[model samples]
Target: MTELREAAPSAGTDLLDERTRELADYCAAMTGRLRVIGQRLDRDPDAITEFLHEPQVRFPVQGMLPPQYRSAGEFPAPLVAASSTVLGQVVATEQVAYGDPNVILASPGPSLSGGVVQALADEQQRQRYFGRLAAAPTHTFFALTEPAKGSAALELETTLTPAPGGGWLLNGAKCYIGNGARAQLGVVFCRRAPGPWGIEAVLLDTSAPGFSGELLPTVGLRGARISRLRFQDVAVAPEDLLGADRSPSRRGLYGATYILYRFRPGIAAMALGCAQAACDYLRTHRATLPRQDRHRLDGVLDRIAAVRHRTYAVAAAVDAGVVDVAGIGAVKARAARVAEDATRLVAELLGPASLIEHPWLEKTYRDVRAFELMEGTTNLHTMAAFQSLLRSRTALQPAAQRAVDGAARH
Candidate 1:
């Protein structure tokens, strides 16, 4: 309880958190072993399940779930200290990611789906969903992206029809969903009728009739079991529709959007961690390189520092209940770009042969690229940032043109 007293002036967060610093430090120490398993998991994605309960793998996953659901000892004391805030999640997520993004991704406990539950699930739904998680170490996924819809997820083609007798039927396909094939339970988005307000989300079981999912041969982040799903009139109960107890306006898309706003920073933190990993890899192996090459690596470190500080600031803002949509979008987009940039620069400076020689750095390159496509792409975020700026009147507009004698008409 002492760890939760208040933010201290000078221990961790001079950069981290005065109290949460210990958790961040502990996570950093654990990455070495997590990294080993991460690489092995990349080689064989199935290997993850066997190691799910190991402390390095389980601690971070447990940390993400509500403390009420997880066992007492899984979280470090520092983690318990910071578990109450979005910033604490950010700190824990970033540091654990520094070990291996796959380690956390493969060990499931709600994840993106949990965010939706937090935002819109009724009390019963909350217990039912999270209770399933509390029962054991389980895998859960969020299914929204589709083959045709891409990032425009709100324009859903999937449909949820009322059953002849009662309950409902879910029919749609979602692709590029993480942990889709292997997850025991999940959340699916679909349209109950026409128009924007018609769309809704529901809890689903992969074993339900008419549901099928298979892994996609993804080039990166292979451990996530990125997969394609087809739903052929899958059964869904009226109770399964999340937020059904709430008004139409508060259900469906609102919760999905809520998910994006709430989880974007943590996603960004993953990219930030991978960037740090790439940069650290560059620094260690650059000793044999020419002096000029080593200096370029230093510049990348500076950029990482700048990005880290801002990521923390944005995460803290979320904790303060500020959802600056544009800012959050830009943070995710920028962090991903920075990660790709770091990996690319390191690959170049270390020489082409270096990727072959250093497997960890090479793996980092692939994983960072996957980070770009996570949640949304860089292009989507930039447009979102611009739109936010325009809405706020912060974006610069073109100067008004006046017809003059010298002006020529096209």
Candidate 2:
């Protein structure tokens, strides 16, 4: 643990020199903000929720960080770390205020890949000029999953039909949409003009006519406000399209792929946080327990630490650009499973204490379980990785085929 701490600075520097310094400074400032938020939440949790709803506080990044940082792997680590602090504050505040056990499974801002961040930044100048605001506690939805389709994103079902006036009329319903009910703006993935395979992302105003959302009562991460969104003849102006106005096939898959890669690191980070929290809870409660319990706690702690380390290593690989996108599925799959194990460990250590609502352990346990199903489920990721490997093998066969042909000719 001490070695990991010592190596953090150098590892950060190796990723990006000057940018790392800027990130450190930014993190320091964010830390202060988070401290203040945490204090306020501790005192009056409702205030934190209300503050999050405020436009000013809702857009935390605002002018503080530039959007260009999203493409580089080095940029998101500090930003995500800072964001996680805010998430922790939210969790703390929610628990304190409502006395209800809930978990924050989805974040409103950019994907770990920085795509949404870049999109937001590009639109910033226009948003300011038009005074057409996009605010948060601003809910943003990743409408990738569907009921009819398998986890294969290429089989998307939602369709976006272009209108006569160059606007768009969206006709589809998105399920498992996090922040669907409360989000003012939504980033919806849809197939434009044709069918599911032509997926594209478009920004839509939730208040617009023909936009509706229904709550999804979930088993965990209940506080995340997951829901199903229906867009029936929802009229969206041309400007709502997130990326370039190219063919959906050309842009949609690329955007989705980018999101997949970008969010891998963030997912791992969240898992690490959960594992650390679980381990800490166990450590704190171990002393009062029996010797047998203590030994069990120690074993759980060791396992948690190992999983946390593995999660961090995966994030580091992403930052270094050493991660294979296809292989990322394996990492994500393993991380989700590890998160489940860590949650279980916490439960075992806490015994009846784990069931209590006040402590974060119970909530985190439920929240971590959600990870196993979110993004690409563990089974789906495994299949994707295998398919990707098979594709690579198939691509290599042409070389061998040509070599055999040449030998025969000789």
Candidate 3:
């Protein structure tokens, strides 16, 4: 227990802590720059469109390291802090909603691919694939959700069959994939048949033959570059298989689950930032509203504050290495709700002006809707939270356990 506790701090420390004012200040300064960039992007429609497709706009190459610094180690806490800060800044600007498809693809997008590669790929394989990021501004994606199989992501229809000589043949389509059309590399999930072990993932170069992508238009997050990808006998090398080559990992969806657990909190923070921005906007215009309307706005502000604090608490726990996986889902779901509700309230306060005149709040309403569906759906989080609660209750039921033990003895 002592050793475990000792090892935990190696992961990262809380930037929010008073002692870490330097780091906090650093994050703030960077976010301020991001805000300026976001505002700039918002002004030019063509610039924002081009920015969506630019690899550097979302995942800046400046944040990446040289080959010497790269290693197959646990994710650094600083990356999460930096990512959350970037996302929050962008969301707050209510610019192009850069965080969702951009930061989502930027941070966790690579993290998921890197984690899978590290966990499953050989050392040589790791160096080849992971090196691409540092080599240049590369875009990578995690393609799991299909049009029909989003909710049942584990039950993949994409099939991977053994190629004639040495690789696997990939055939199927993936939809609503962030950065899919633009990514240089991606981890595509597939199955041999249907059950747990059948579900597997493979790394592939997006430029490979037999692979094609069509950009999927979205109501919100126009810059996200979401794509519907079709793979027609796209050959994947044996080394490209995640976890293990040839045979699939029997544990079933463990890799996907791990990625979600690690990244969901940051995504939640993105939503929280949106909510905070809405509250901030509302507060600025609060005095102009009628007296009766002020009370309702105050109530909305309190709810937004609650959600923001809850998100921060979860982020702190994550940094301390003490957060429950299920708690991430809970926090994300709550944040999504708060963001959606806050934006709706703001729209109501602004009336048609928000919809017609101001693109900020209008875009935000659309962007926040994506949060409830992204990372994990609200229903999925609800189930996870309920399951977590049940487990906690069982752990605390000492008397019931004792009764069962006595019955067995008798």
lDDT by residue (201-281, candidate 1, tens digit) is 899988898999999997778888899999998989887899987887788888888877878888888888888777767
Residue lDDT tens for model 3, 143-192:
88888878376678889998899788999999888778878887888886
Model 2 C-alpha RMSD vs. true structure (Å) is: 7.4
Top-TM-score structure, candidate number: 1
lDDT, each prediction: 0.79, 0.54, 0.61
Q: lDDT of candidate 3?
A: 0.61
- Per-model TM against the reference: 0.90, 0.69, 0.77
Alpha-carbon shift of residue 46 in model 2 (angstroms)? 8.5
Better candidate number, 1 or 3, judged by lDDT: 1
Specify the highest-lDDT model's number: 1
Q: Which regions in candidate 3 have their CA more than 4 angstroms from the true location?
A: 1-15, 18-24, 30-111, 245-252, 287-291, 319-323, 394-398, 401-410
Please identify model 1 stretches exceeding 4 Å from their true place. Answer: 1-12, 288-291, 394-410
